[model samples]
Structure formats: C-alpha cells, structure tokens
Target: MFLTPAERIADYQARGWWEEIGVDALLRQAVAERGATLALVDPLNRKTLDGCAPERLSWNELDARVDAMAAALIALGLERDDVICAQLPNTVDAVILFLAVARLGLIISPIVMQYREHELGHILSLTDARAFVTVPTFHGHDYAAMAAALIAERPGMMLLTMGAAPHGADLRALAASADPASVAPWCAAHPVAGGEVLTICWTSGTEARPKGVPRDHNHWVLNAKVIVWGTGMQPGDVLLNPFPLVNIASIGGLMLPWLEVRGTMVLHHPFDLSVFLKQIEAEHVTYTIAPPAVLTALLKQPQIAASVDLSSLRAIGSGSAPLTPWLIEGWAETHGIEICNIFGSNEGMALMSSPIDVPDRTERAHYFPRFGAEGVDWDSPVSAVMRTRLVDPETGAIITEPGRPGEMHISGGTVISGYWRSPELNGASFDGEWFRTGDLFEIAGDGALSRFYRFVGRSKEIIVRGGVNISPAEIDELLVSLPGVREAASVGIPDSDLGERIAVAVVVDDGITPPDVAAVGAHLAAAGVAVFKRPERLVVLSALPRNAMNKVVRADLRAAVLAALES
Candidate 1:
C-alpha cells in the first residue's frame, strides 16, 4: 500500500499533479519554489503592475508582503473566519490582498469591478464582510461612491481604498510601512487549518438566487494543482488572462497554475484587441483565455495581418461564451495556433482540453471529457488524474452503456464538496461523491470524448419547441457569427404551433441593423443551422445586459422577448 500510494502520487506529480497543498501551503510553496522568479508581469505599466521597472519579486519578497498585509488586517481587529470583500480589477493590490487574507485565514470574497449599489449590497450583506477594499474610480464609475453606499447599509464594515483615498476610507499608505517580519510571526501564530473556508464564490443566478460557494484552503490548492496538470502547464510559460482576477477562471486558470509551475503571467486590465495582441508579442505569452467576442474582434483588426508576430503563442483557450467551430478552424488555419475550449461552472466541476487533445476544429468546437476515465475500468490503467462519468439526468443514476446521453459528473481531487452555507443544494450538487456537473453530454463508444457535448442548455432556459429541446447557447453561437452582428443572445418566446419560438436579441455593429426576418432566416440557412433552431424574430439592442460578473442576464432577456411578442 505504501509503495502503491507513493507510485500513484509520483505518477500524478510527473504529470504536474498534486494531492492538496491547501491555500496556506500553496502560497508557502510558491514562495519556496522560485522566490526570485517573476510570478506576475503587466506590460501596460511596469511600475504599477510590478511595483517598479524590472519589478520582480523573489519568494522572500512575496512572502514578506503577504505577511505585512496579514498582520495589518489582524491589527485592524480582523479575526479568523471573518470575511473581507474586495471590489477591484486585475491589479497588484488585489493579488496582495488575497495572499494577505489567506495568511490570516480570513475568507476573501472578491466581486467584479462593474458591480454597482444593488449587486454590491447583496454580496456584502450576504457575506457580512467585515472589511471592504476598492479603487477610488475605474473606467467611468465611482468605486468610492458604490462602496460608500454599501457601507452606509452595513455601518460596522471597514472600508479600504486603492489608488486614491476617499473621505470615509483608510488609505493603503500604512500597509507599506508595516513590518513583514512581524506578519510572518503572526501567520505562524494563526496557521490556516486544512478545512477552513478561504473564499466565497457566487453562483450565476440565472434561474434562482445566487448561492455563496465556500471553498477552503485544501480544496482550492488541490483544485489548482489538478488544473495545472490537466491543462499541461509548465514553468517559464507566460499566461495571458483577460478575465478579471475575481472570477473562477482567474483562480484556476492563472493564479494557481502559474504559482505551482513558477511561470510568468501577463495580466491585462481589460480586453482591448490591440493591447492584448501587443502584450502577447512583447511578453512572449504561451497561453491565454479570452471570450469568443475578443477573438472575433481580433480577427477583424487589419493590423493583425502585418504587425503581430504571434509565434510565441502555443495554445489559446476560450469560455464564458460558446465558441463556434468556424472560429476555431479559422484561427488555427490562419495563425497555426491551437484553439481549445473549456466547460466549467462554479459548482466545482470543470473539463479542460489540451492542444494535443483537441488538434482539429471539430474537437475545439465540441469535445468534453467523459466521466470515469479511470474508476470505470480497473483492468486498464489510466494516467489522467481526473475522472468523469455520464449519468441519467432525472434519476441521477449512473449510465453504464455507451451511446446514451446524460449529465456529466466528475470526481477527482479538484471537485469541491459542497456550496457554502447551502445545505439544500448539497444533495442536488453531488452523486455519492462526484460533483454533479449541470452540463448534459453523451460519451462516445471508444472512451474518447467528442469535441461537442450538447449543452442541452440551462435547466430552466431550455426551449421546448414542439417538445424538442433547443439550447439557447446553440442558437446564440450561430446568431453572433452573422455579418454586422457584434453579439447575440437568444430566448424562447411563446408560440402556438411550437411550444416556444426562438427570439434573438442582438447588438449590431456600427452602421448595421437587422434586415428583415426573411433576411435573417436566409443567413441562418446559409450557415447550415436547422430551420427550427433559427430565430423567428430579431430585436436590436444597444448592448446585451450583463450582471456584475459580465454574465448575460438571460432571464431578463427572456422576459423582454416575451413582452416584445405581446406588444
């Protein structure tokens, strides 16, 4: 048993696998692995991004800063199990805040920067965050104003600001003056236990209220290591992440993997095509994840044909929006770079592919990992660390035979146990021990997963057109690719012939509008989408409405589509 367990661990490690280092230990390891390595880089402004030009930190420097921030928070009377909320973009301060909170064993609940009074208030109140961190202003909105509004509701909350100090908030100046040696001793005094909750993730409230996802140091560290191994990450690789640091994509996509591999990350503030392409060239980025919207804009830019030397890029991954097969094949043939797609949710389940795993356009468009890659066949030894399964959606029973479509359930070291404080969801979220992935899928006979696992759409958002289910994501992907359309969203409107008719809400690019319903139909027909899946009507919108996290408010759009039909 000793040798077998050791062999199992060794197998995983060779593939960049780890059991569970936990959050506290994860930071410790990053400090120890290559203390002198440049863990993060921002080319936009080296000084602000890295602290100074040639701005680099050894493990000692990062550890010291984490300690100082931890001690400072403790000095401010923050205790174990307390929650500190941060509302900021992808900045050095936000990184420091997470490390500091982890050292003190305080839960770090980070909300997106775009969140206003309403969304901000709900998260703050729900977490009962004792302290808050923010930037004075970003883009065009007043962060201080929003923070102040929330603070008024929760008078006991402590407010901390970055960049500029607001009237009612404490400045960040004192943190720099604090001693790191003292903070290290403080971390030693209050060590983070294995099962302690380190962060709270909010689920997308598409159908119901958003539930808080509480993850502990152990689960987070384990998940990060799993992601690193699964995605085939390594040292010296540069990862460009357009998703804000607050999202789960940031947590699993860049932070953990880069830290574990002792790699570099080129952090971008916002997704700007020119800036993004320039950074990829300048920093020699090897990996990145952007929404399909970003990719569409990049291809349209004329400068891409001449100025961009994209040889350094190895793999490009996309999510947060469905990626079409057309986009995947077009980019690969054009740039000679592999485009991979990932399916992930906040429910602690994710499936990611590598350049090798998804070599062609079809794989990039549709393949998702099947469950029980290892646990299913004991006779056959499997090397992959994570295992997946397909099961009946209604009964939650395991599906043994192939060619049957069912929901995907994944179990491995990375899957989280349950949502924070939501006992009601636990039963539905898990099957025995595997995290029940909400995605519906069908595993092929050869044990090789297809590039296209049918989304079957969201449970509530599924369009029942004459009793045949139609996923909005499927239609939305096709609609967005049309000429003159910047982006598209679909919802099911009432219908007499069919149960529901597909209604499309689209944002047309400059000097473009939806032609006639017949014109739209003709375009879909050209694209090879089934006639039934095509939207019967199109509504032009200035922009698709998004929540604080940049997720489309599909429910709200459905309501609008219904109203438009009635009107």
Candidate 2:
C-alpha cells in the first residue's frame, strides 16, 4: 500500500521503526509540518579556524530559498533530468543547491573541490553536465580561472559562481531575487516522482576511470529510512556531518536522515577537530558522522574535554574508513556517545551495524555482527534487502558455506545499476543481476557478519591515494618511457594528509643515481598522466620489491616505502 508521507512517518514512529520511510516524503513532510523550525545551520566563519559561528535557517526559510533557486535554475534552462555539477566546499550554498536541484527533479553531480582538471574532466564528460555551480576562490587558488579554462574547452556548459563572478558567468544572486511566490507555483507544477533520478555521484577509485552512479529519490529515501532507524535519530536532533558531502555516508547517512526526521543540521566547512567539538557544545549537536580519526583527535584535545559540553550528543555514525575497537570504546567511555561502525563503498552501503533496538554499550564484540563461513553465509536469503556472497578467488565460483573467506559480491536495490558509458565494465560488473563489490571478506558464526574482514587489497594494481584510484600499471608504463629510467614500480605509501601517496620505486640504469622530485614531475608531465595519479614522492631502490616468482609484491613495497618515509 502507498501510504501518504504523514501516514508513513506516523506508522513508523508507532511501530518504533522511525527509520523505514523515504527521505523525499520526509523532506516534503518537514516543509509541510515543521516549516517554522530551524532545520539547518550554516557556519558563517571565514574558511578558517577560530571564527566559526552558527547561522541558522528555519525550514520555511530553507524551503523558500530552495524553491527560488530551483525556479532561477529552471529559468536559466536547467531541465528535469539535466545534470548540474557542484564543486564547492561544505557551505550553505552546497546544501541549498542540492535541495533546489532535487526539488526540480534535476540530477545533481557533486564533486570535491580538491579534484583538479584530470578528475573534473572525466565527470564533466561522463555526466554531460549542462551547468556547473562553484566558488570563485577556495583555500587560495582562483577557481574562477579553472572554471573559465573548462568553459573554454566545453562551450556548451553554463556557469554559476557563488560570492564572486568571472566573465561570462551568471551570478548566484539571481537565486536570491527569484520570488518565492513565483517558484511555489513552479514547484507545484513540477512535483518530483519517487523513482525519478535525483543525483549522479561519480565513484572514487584509483584503478579504472570513475563511474557515474545514478541514484533516484526512492533509493536515497529508502536508504535514509534505514539509516534513521539504524542510528536512532530524533525529530529535534542536531546532526553534525563531518564527512565530505561527496561521499554517500554524508549524503545518505547524515543529510538525508536529518531531512527525513525534520531535525537540524549543523554544517562545518571542513573537518577541524577542536572546532567540531566546540560546535557540538555550541549548537547542542545530537548526532554526527565522523571517522575514527576525528574521534581520536577529539579525545586527545584537552580543551574539548574541559571547555565543551557534549551531553546532548546521542549518536556518532562513523564511516569513509573502518573504525578500530579502541576508538569506539574510548569515545563511549568518555563521551557516552554510541559508536556505530558502518561498512560502505562508493557502490552502496553494506552491513555490520549496531542494532537500534538495543542501548549503546561498549561490549566491543557486540558492536559489529560477525558473519562468515564458520557461522552463516552473508549472501543467504535472510539478508535479502542487501545480498552478499563469498566466491572463490581464482574460479569466481560461489562459496555456499560459512568457513571460507573469498571475494565478496553484492546485489540489491541500493547498488548502482551500472557504470556510466562503460559497456565493457558493465558487462563484467553485472552477472545478469548482481553488482560485484570487488572486496574480499569472511563470513562469521551466529549469522552476524564480521566487520573486521581483511582488505586483501584491490583486485587490480591501483594505488588508493586517499579514495582516488591511481592505476600503477598506467603510471609504470609512463615512467619507463622517460629518457633515463631502467624500470619503475608505482606503489602507494601512507601519508597523513592524502590517505596514500603514489611513490615510484625506480631501478636506475647502472650509472644513474635517484632523480629529484622535480625531474620525476617532468617525466610524468611528458607522459601525460593525470595530475593526481603522478607520483608525489619517489624512492630509488637497488631492486624492486618482489616475491619468489619475481612478481613485484606491491603491498610489501608500499609498507617498506612508507616506513622509510616515516623514519
């Protein structure tokens, strides 16, 4: 039965299933029911530390802004299904832009600000984006110059610059002037259907090209329901999302859940541990999605412990990386916040979450359910909403029982339909039905999947520098073509800022010593490698790290190379 938005929320609340409704209905309901309440708070501080303060906007204000923006965008020729790429930081504009685009049923393509031409070009080409909304400057560089360059290359695209405008760009001020009264009729005339595509988020990886994953209102809405239920979000709760908006956890777990519940969202431009804790106290934040690193830093800050009041914090949903038990247990002991470890990918969210029915406790083992060959296969019918299986690494044959670890595969409503424009990849990813997750794991006993599955690492030779996939084979081929290199092994070394740094371990032809970083840059530039894929660090080893069969043991090389850098 198709229950109305009110009915769905009422029913779910009554059944203690506060997490089962769609986010679209939830947003619509909030506008109808909680329009007078402050739904989102943007930070007014300069893009720097120490000056952050809350700038609250009520649901009514937000709704009007979104409608006006949607109308202005439509007036500028953005159509229903047309893609609008957003490459801004976490700001009020970013949040409102997404809402405005969704309101009109237009597809939003959000990319991170860090991405230079290489990453940006792929997404622009793939999504066939009709327009791009961005800032004139961020962190120092003139983004206006970048956008102008891109416009010169792709003349068909439109541009909307926030705060400042370059030549041949429409100012975002057009949105501010659009009469809400006029936009109301426009929104009423163009209601978004549940299954219409809402966004196309490009997947981040280091190996192959990025894939554009299309998500509809229904998919996101349902995922919101699940996250709300799983995380125990309340209507008046304040959700602090520290994760980048580019990833699904921020979109599905934080943004959608808060909108679905008519809760308040506290936005910070970027992750600053001390400022985050301070905001938690100042805004009375009730929930947040922070990785373990954020948690660890918060615990170590004496100012956070002494100056802030975190009593209102109820839950902290951590993702983007795995959480160690120490991080979870430490925070639970100190702050009384529940640590729910979520395992997800660019594809979609997978499991190993804490049960919502129970109270938050630090019984370590009870936190993440264990599932593997010893107990039950996670791919069984019980986990029908999301399916997973352990397959033989070599043969790709399904492993039916519980005791063995193999490659993990998933197929469900939440997974992306397929990669954009990659017919060959689409052929390999879909086995007539399931999308291959490309991860390796073991199932556990008690039918609960273990969260501690080993990352045997990428199936391909790609350097995962942070979440960006840099193909080593692609880099190696390029490096060897350079004038004086004998051989090269492209490997990723752990770096504090970038999750990983691509390092080329070169074998110099007998006479040549190690080349400096600048020379390495020249070689990569000459080879025409992507900017992010080029080696940020280089190492000259007498011989390449290899296994008994003479195959380069990239993993061992990465560890050794990183250890040397750290030393």
lDDT of each: 0.66, 0.67
lDDT of 2 by residue, 287-396 (tens): 88765556666677746565779899887876445455667777778877787766676566455455352233443323333332233334322133455666777998
lDDT of 1 by residue, 1-567 (tens): 011133444544465544433466766776777678767664475344324343345567767767777767877788878888888777556777887887777888887665555456667878888988887776656777767876987878988886555534553565766666666676667766655677886654322334567766655676666566556667668888665666567877777677677677677776567778888998888888776666765666636744878888877877655567777876777787767676665555666644544455676576654423534432111124467777797786776665677877776545566666566677767665577666666655554543234444444466655433466765666566677778878887766335468788877778776665677777766654445666788787778878999877877888776666668
- Stretches of candidate 2 exceeding 4 Å from the true structure: 1-24, 44-54, 181-190, 300-304, 355-384, 400-403, 445-487, 494-501, 517-537, 542-567
Instruction: Give candidate 2's whole-model lDDT.
Output: 0.67
Q: How high is the lDDT of residue 322 in model 1?
A: 56
lDDT of 1 at 246: 69
- Per-model C-alpha RMSD: 10.7, 5.7
By summed lDDT, the worst window of 10 consecutive residues in model 2 runs over 364-373
TM-score of each: 0.74, 0.83
